[model samples]
Target: MATMNRQHHLRGVLLASVACILWGISGVAASSLFMLNPHITALWLTQVRMISAGMILLVFGQFAGVKPFAIWRQRATALRVVSYGLLGLVPVQLCYFEAVKFGNAPIATIIQYLGPFIISIYFLLFKHVTPTRPEALGMIMAFFGTLLIVTHGHLNSLAISPVVLFWGGLSAIGVATNTLLPRPLLPKFGAVSVTGWGLLVAGICLNVFGPVWQDHVTLTGAELALILVIIILGTVIPFLMFAHALGYILPTTASLLDAFEPLAATVFSVAFLNVQLTNYDLFGGMLIILAVMALSLNGRKMINFLRSFRTE
Candidate 1:
């Protein structure tokens, strides 16, 4: 029994690692597509990715006996799907891709990783929750890391464009929504089912603005392949693994393990895309990763503290 449990634990870690690797690599792939076609808007990519990946996940879930469409059968679940789709999924994709469009994937990813800090701050200010030592340390690390990344260790001048920073910061908040907003729905339906329906609904909502059909962008073979990677590796696989990992491991452990994502993304960007990072980038990114580790490992303690505060 011990050996079997150990094997399962190892398998979960491996799957989570592979999922993060795929996510990190897929961001570079998306960056390549954006580089090839400067005219290809982020909106187009979001629409295509959400719609295609969304359907694939839903259908795949059905085969796995997931019944993704079960959400539509419940009024509350159906409403949650719409809310998650529009506010949670759509904004995150739009902002993350737009950040990638403006900047390289590595920095954008590191910036997005600041989501947990944002959440911690919110709980501190609005929820009247005091952070424990770990949470406080995490918040400080995240803040300094973001500052270093943005200013490139030069607190006086900005390293990247202000426009890119705007989108990246927004995407970080979007990450918070993506993580926290789905909690209620996750208990009612499996993560896969809720995620699929959310993605589908998000795609539909995005399409209301203007369909990609209205675009003049042309897709080459390379572009088509990259899109497939983004849909499958980036969107579908990561979600599936991260969600599945929760079943076998603590969410905090899973979150700590996901630090590999930014590392992988950085390596891929430097190796394949010839994107170079400064010393500041590496150090700042490391600090942010430490923050992530702190946040994940200490999340429950912080939550308990928050509940105590509320009761008192």
Candidate 2:
């Protein structure tokens, strides 16, 4: 049993790592889309992402013997799906776009990473579950590292526009809620089914509110092709991997691993966008990587340490 648990954890970690890698690449992809227009890019990407991911997952759910519509009959399940769609999927993308509009992609990505720390606080205060010492340290390290990256080591330049900061903070909250909301439903309904339904509902919401269809969208062949790639590789595949991994991992663990997305974005930017990598970026990335490693390998020890300190 011990060996089996270890193997399971290893697999989950691998899956989460891959998800972060794909998410990191998405920054590069989104930057490419900026060549067209930011609003159009945001609208189309959200529409394509939600719709394509929804359809793919729905097909998968059906193959797995889960009917997507059947979930709607259960009001609670339907509500949960809607909550995931509206509160989870929509806000993350929208706020991210808004943040990027006011700030650079790297800065926006770093601010959005505030999600894990938000989750940590939520768990610590509301759930009354003190994180272990290692986890607490990891959280602190990750937070500072992300801040350093966002502020570009200057720390004084951290004063972003108010609107951008607000949206970025909201994006973090959205991620925290999304990560926490699925726990109760995962056991009753499979993660795939829940994710599929939520995505479908969210896709519909995006379409309804999105400006792409409103403008009677037309796309260049290149743009259309890129959109399809974003939908398939960027949105659908990553979310499926996420759902699968979430089934085998703790939410906190999953969120901690997600910190790698920004680091991955940094690498992708350096490679494709001609973004310079300074010593600060390297140092910050190393700290975030170490923090994630500590959380993954020694979470329980960290949690215990925090608990003891709190009690003392």
| lDDT (0 to 1) per candidate | 0.84, 0.70
lDDT of 2: 0.70
Can you list the residue pairs that collide in candidate 2? 131-303, 132-302, 132-303, 132-304, 133-302, 133-303, 134-302
Scanning candidate 1 in windows of ten residues, the lowest lDDT window is 303-312
Give RMSD to native, each candidate.
Answer: 2.6, 5.0
Per-candidate TM-score against the hidden true structure: 0.94, 0.80
lDDT per residue for candidate 1 within 1-312, as digits (tens), equals: 999988888888887888888888877988999999887888999999988888988998999998777778878768867888887887678888888899989998898888888778777788777888888888898889888888977788999989789888888888777766776777667888888888888987887788768877888998989998999888898889878777777667778887887898899999989998999899999999998898888789655654454344
Highest lDDT: give the candidate number. Answer: 1
Per-residue error (Å), model 1, residue 112: 0.1
Q: Among these predicted structures, which one has the highest TM-score?
A: 1
RMSD of 2: 5.0
